[model samples]
Target: MEAPIKAPTPGAGGCGTVWWQSGTVYQIYPRSFQDSDGDGVGDLRGITARLDYLAWLGVDAVWISPFYRSPMADFGYDVADYCAVDPLFGTLADFDALISEAHRRKLKVILDFVPNHSSIAHPWFTESRASRMSAKRDWYIWRDPGPDGGPPNNWLSNFGGPAWTRDEATGQYYYHAFLPEQPDLNWRNPEVRAAMHDALRFWLARGVDGFRVDVIWHLIKDEGFRDNPQNPDFQPHQAGINRFHQVYSCDRPEVLDIIAGMRAVLRAYGERVLIGEIYLPIERLVTYYGPGLTGADLPFNFQLIQTPWRAEAVAALVAEYEAALPEGGWPNWVLGNHDQPRIAARVGEAQARIAAMLLLTLRGTPTLYYGDEIGLGHVPVPPERAQDPWGRNEPGHGRDPERTPMQWEDAPNAGFTAGTPWLPLTGDANRRNVDELRDDSRSILTLYRRLLSLRRDHSALSVGAWRGLALPSDLAAEVFAYERIADGETLRILLNFSNQGWSVPLDEGGPWQILLSTHSGRAGDRVERQLRLEPDEGVILGPPGR
Candidate 1:
């Protein structure tokens, strides 16, 4: 077994830096994380019951997906009552208890805030659609039909087909970016903005540390309601939304101002963070930082998820992203999320270890998708058990494969639920699970624990300035290397993206120990002038002459 890591002194990075700046955030999909009370679904109490596990795993924060009152059309993404908890996830009291339990464990709670749209069942939408002359009618986007009596323009829903749905009673059509049941909110409406802002305050009042704002870029659309231009290189196999470049539909100029407004609200309350879920390019993504560093505290960076898994490709992506950050901007990394495939599934089991090493050691706050640490692979979702609206509409677009239940042990349902799990467990759970791997010295769980423990112990890995290390041109093809420097302490991270042993000269030539390694057996080994990396291995090395 790996040696236990002692607690590191708090505030080691510095006093002015916020906890999130140097800490790790773990995303918990409540419905898939654990099912407390065994009602066949996960609830707030289920998450509360697992706080000890998260705290033990060394996570600094827990970002739970939406738990608000919803009609479940788009799962919890379509909110009906911003201030109330859904019956499936328990009551408001249950949510409070979760906050209490999480805080007691010193783990910050980050909630998923869906500000872009609301369920058609929402009272506000109900009233707004009651009549064209209704006072709340303008609260949502409702436009008249086109000349041919079809959708206003060529815009399409993320789920598929037209973005507009006609309401026969009013001869007008409402817009929804995703599901028709989820109508787009008129963020252009001042009252809507205020109400949504107040929703943040509602949780802030109840002790939420921050929010992972869902689809923040989709909050504001083009003012003219113009058609999104078609992609010149569109493909038949890609998402339908991709047929258009989203020129007029998303990432509009006004989004920056709206994001800054959210930041202002967070700043009013001390130390709270706002993380926007943006899938734009690096150049445009940085703009979410706002004009004067006043936008999202951490506009979620997901380039790693889309970039090819190769040394040169990843290094280039990292450099491009770092260089693109606006002044005073902070960076964050995400390896996986509810909407994407798991790391292990994407890069194979062996490379997943290297991916973990890179994630925890990289110069940014890292968000760990639930079940990633234990090396959970994607669980196949049979047609009968499929749950994602996107996949149901588009055969290959479903995210159900990645939204499986957490494997806590070798029990039936992987100990996630007593009755039946909302999603099937990856059959490998019996051999690869927290209970089975926590005691195994070379298990992925142990590697993650060690990496997190090392990150906690070293300020360099947490808040240090990252600089890429130069390798001979011919020798740099399959290896990625960088240095993290803090308070004169320098650490080098070397990763071999290929499944072939590679060696790099340790030019500094002094006493150096492998602080941590992707291959567990290789960790803590002493090294010198020549460093050889096992196939698909990654290692963090203390500076020479130390």
Candidate 2:
């Protein structure tokens, strides 16, 4: 609960102040975090009101989802105005106040920058679509219709439908890799690149610590507008239209130049960090941190968010990511977020605590989604009640299941809104609210607090080197075991992912101390000692020779 002890250096790489090294980041879905005006939606003021809660949780930074002026087409991701806050969230002064308060609590703020596209309502797009040679027309990607009066090429949006839309006024089809209303920005243009860089400077000048670049890899498209090849294993959701491999559509080699330009702007401000959202293979993902170019400080690692719940699989992934990290590049982990289902829902309620342990103890920076520490699960929304644009298009298969509002209290609207919430509150809101579980020592929040405290107190758990241990096949499938070594201190972390009991051989030749355990049990020194782990149990053991 005490304030975090300030490290000696504020921006040095390593355990001290590497943008993301060993830091705990709390993600705030602004519209669902809290409502300041009883308007049934959260805003910047709501986040300011909850700073103490974040401080108590020991998080070092807060990654707030987009709050720019928008049409609410895709929540805040579809930016209508980049320079000011949406009236719904509050005034620009409110954002400044939020930033000041966050820093006062020693928490850094990272804004979500959606550079891939902007809402069609954006002024730049409006004028660009008004007429040919309008000076801003080239700001966005506009192409001629295909030979058969269809789309320009065989490109598909991640959300659904054609990636291009025809404009009756100009007889051109504009590109939109996501929603039809959200058109992709043409990064190939020098003027466009300069404008986006100015946008970055605008926030850095406002004292924003950094940005979480959304869809960083999708910034550049194939200049020739080539058709993507058909995917061999396309499913129903991605097939029928043009389920193709997007070799030329995204992740172009030219993205590095744009990243360098962005980095150059950040370098002007001492100690700025840029975390990119790039989903690719481990080898390709690390390349975002270019060999000689100024790459991102941390590429948001979504492996934990996408991996299955098997112990061996997770262990292998952890090792692979650590190995794949580029030199001078710090690794990061995200277990849950506004766009994905909560880890508690993905695994199970019983395993939530263990997942938290694994997350905090892992050898990298950890980002915890809002309300995740309380073991919040996704609330199933009926098709008619869904608000996600993707869900609106497909009706049932989109992410509406995970984007529900946060549960703050057991009162009406789960203390998220006094009026009707934009989304429905979950059925478990009454019991899962913060006030109900904060006092319970065994609650998931309390477990998170303890885990964070342990991480902060011990160097081995935070900035240590991880070494995977091999166990029996059956035990390996259900139990994850790894050792962390730093500053001559070694800590062994063992977690049981399943509900069944599992055992691992412990080194009995030397004294082994039980530093922490989710289950109320103890371990003593013994040669070849057997550890009987209960379901969802976790134990952190001190160094073998300590």
Candidate 3:
């Protein structure tokens, strides 16, 4: 195995926090980030070419989405070979260079490890399907048909149909939580667990700092294959997955044992981090931390994405998450991802700036989605150009709008490729490209860089204790404020969610200066007594010395 990267020693300076806790993690959708070749698709070299930008932007790490060998059924989520990079992405040597270059630049590399399922074309699945008595037949979840000769049970696939697919030769059904092309692995099998653990070791041996395990909660299913209870609260507007309670299909208690095993493997690798992609409510979500915080280093808190964006609501959400964390469990936050809509599209550009401040100033780790820093909203995709399977399977809900190619420059195809882009580019790509935004003093990209720089400079912002500032009943609905304290330094972040100006009282004495502002050009303003804020603005305040 490659020698583990030595951990940074903690001290009163910014190094006091562990690497994962001290800085932001930026997620890159490889296929849309940059295309080095003229094939209209991004490759590993494309990502290698962007490491300098990430380091310059001040993010400490990058969490790349899956690029494993696959048939592209679910866009790399369906892994056909766990240990090899698909030729579409490049050779294994390209992956090694990515790791070496990222580490050389002092940036941690985290890969998306998809363990719940594999492409049906994978060798293991192919061998398992040869006949009912195939030694590997038990490697996947298979059962005889239900009494009616329909699906084994009522469990629905996340892609919008029965989760089971009949095997013509074997005279049985195999379960898949997503597309039928992707078959769920039988985690209950010891051999299956051993093989998947080996896959992780393969990457760790190559010097990856960590993994963001995909569908972590779906690792183990209910052994009985029972039908899920109906969700009474379901509505016509919700996705098909919400039609049931999902008790039998996923998030089973047994999954904790499986997680414990995975955690053990990561523990063997010095200071390696494990982040689980879980979408459970805060109550159940905290359980993923396992007893004494051994399950996942970070459970991927997505409450911010699902919560209503009102000031009072967001404050309460933060409070609940803080209270729900296990005693020693670390917290993390995410605003957008390849699977979700862009923050700018959900809330207008004015508030995307505030969202950036909120994410950075929060108590725990924050993950920034690529292009979100430049205020990229959903790029409308025409029906003929739609590429996402989810959008193709379900109309009006496709993620293609949010997964468009990144706008790097004003050149053809927004400088993402020399050939036709695999996806469409945003309408504002001409004016909002990174090359243009970098030089604009008041661009959202500048705001993001400023916020990140502040985190590195202030111990309080990077690893401080957080306390929500109390607001009077009326103002509470219109304003959200919080204080972060560490290293004898105190910093306050105040956000105005409303469109009108308001005056908020300073409970404590302060001749505080504005450290940064979302509207830009407001830095270094003195504040004392009641501070007046402009409409739709957010500001960070610190003692006057700086």
- By TM-score rank, best first, the candidates go 3, 1, 2
TM-scores for all predictions: 0.97, 0.94, 0.97
Consecutive 10-residue window with the lowest summed lDDT within model 3: 1-10
Model 2 lDDT tens row, 440-520: 877888788878888877776777666777777888888998877666676778899888887778753235677667764
Model 3 ranges off by over 4 Å: 1-16
The C-alpha stretches of model 1 lying farther than 4 A from their native spots are 1-12, 543-546
Q: Relative to the true structure, how large is the alpha-carbon lDDT of every model? A: 0.88, 0.82, 0.89
lDDT per residue, candidate 3, 90-158, as tens digits? 989999999999999999999999999999999999999998889999899999999999888999988
Clashing residue pairs found in predicted model 2: 34-42, 508-526, 508-527
Residues 29-124, model 1: lDDT tens digits: 988888888877888888988899999899999999998999998889999999999999999999999899899999999999999999999999
Looking at candidate 2, the ten consecutive residues that score lowest on lDDT are 1-10
- Model 1: colliding residue pairs: none
Prediction 3 global C-alpha lDDT: 0.89
